[model samples]
Target: MRPTVTPCEDFNAEEDAKALKKAFKGFGTDEDAVIEIITKRSNEQRREIATVYKTMYGKDLVKDLRSELRGHFEDVIVALMLEPVEFQAKELHRAVSGLGTDELSIVEILGVHDNDEVVAISNAYEGLYQTSLESDIKGDTSGTLKRLLVGLSTGRRDESCDVNEEAAVKDAQALLQAGELLFAGTEESVFNSVLCQRARCQLRLIFDAYNNLVGHPIEKAIKNEFSGTVKDALLQLIECVRDRTSYLATRLHDSMAGIGTDDRTLIRIVVSRSEKDLEDIKEVYYEKYGKSLAERIADEEEVPSDVKKVLMQLLL
Candidate 1:
């Protein structure tokens, strides 16, 4: 995985803070300097800069950025400035708090993270909002999706890399019975238990065994048996476990294709993954869609040039 922002060798938190203050002080903000400092520094460095900026200027860095920047550029900068876990927690809160839930955002976050990451996000959520992530998910979602999100937020997935072939076979049969056979309606618990608790490696084995036993892929069974948000969540889990990069690539494509762009989704994926697997996502996107992610974004005449420039920088 290639990250756009790695640790800078000569990083000085105080100096970066001064530069940011200077950028914000003048009549017109030096957008380029703001972007250069915020996007190029590592997350840890950005956190440090926030602390120093507060100590030096008695002002909140994020608040200052919010005052100075506007539109998608502001969104990208603010998202990048936040600690990763806090950013994710905020995203979770944003997704679930409104009148209608952004189920895809909930799924993207809750489905993809591993046990440790989930635990961190849950903790961060409580810390930020003084409310439990589980409660928020339960309140926002209903039925099977509620159960699935709650299960995912538990952070109880088996973390072992070991694959139990015997257990894989048993789980495969269980999944087949629960999903594909006469016992279809009775499988929600089974789906929750196996999909939520098993390690990704073990799940892969189970999927292979399930395909061999049922004569088709587990995803096919999931699509045939489940519908609506529940099905979407389950399929997201499977796709994330199978190949996270590909899943994210598909999501990025979905955000940009046809109609108006899902700017929130676009910003979330680009900012969140830029320092993780965005390079891989970019490659997969190009391979799958026959156009580079950067190229696609550039083609969108509606997106601000500054925001597009930052996104392209991250992609590169």
Candidate 2:
């Protein structure tokens, strides 16, 4: 229940604005001052600071920061500055807009958000790009993955915590029959249909019931039955339904696991979750991996020193 970043005590908009102006005034940027103000305040507070900064001085804070900062640190700060929903919208747009597509980015955003957040992201996407996110996704993706992204964009899933045990039982059977019980190939539609509409709470019960029905875990069956991006998304949804914190921790790990760091992915997760559940994510990260999330990031040679320092400011 603890978010790493909280609203600062004795916050003053003009004072913060003045401090930021001073940070940007000298020969060199006061990165520590920038990081301190940006990381300590909540997103709402940050927005207020930006507004006051603009009102006090005719200069735009983001533009000034842009002029002063460079590289991944700038990316993180700017991303942090946007409204969360808007940031998500831009991330989705980025995921689809460029050559090829970052299918996993779509999954990361769409899979994690609930009905309202999803709708908000969709609206923000259109507002920012003056185009529909659904169309962009359709253009970029195909097959079941396309369907999944489009489905998630609707924000129609039941967002309640209410559980229906009987329905859960039937859904469990439907999954078993669709996957493991039938030797005749899996019915992927059944998965897509059920996953698209079921409430997260209901999905959890369905998963539990499925486990009880099948001797093994539902994840194993999913791995056996599905393939490609859809399979990864499904597994992530299941993971989210099971333990969101652990899922996010794995995401943090996966971002840094390979040859080079996924700076955008890393920044998005840390920044988005920083004020929400980074604390819980950190706990899960430590419990899953031997080292803490900060320790993991700190060890990554790819992350620049300033980037790592700013990241640690958020983490600790």
lDDT of 1 by residue, 1-316 (tens): 8766577799999999999999987698999999888878888899899999999999999999999999889888999999899999999999998699988888899777878898999999999999999998888888888888888889999999888999999999988887778453656889988998999899999999998996889999888888988788788889988888899999998888788888888888998888888888889999999999999999987678999878877776
Which runs in model 2 stand beyond 4 Å of their true positions? none
Q: How does each model score on lDDT?
A: 0.88, 0.88
On the 0 to 100 scale, the lDDT of residue 180 in model 1 is 77
Clashing pairs in 2: none
Candidate 1 regions exceeding 4 Å error are 183-186
Which run of 10 residues does model 2 get worst, by summed lDDT?
236-245
Clashes of each: 0, 0
Candidate 1, residue 88: how far the Cα is off, in Å: 0.2
| Model 1 collision count | 0
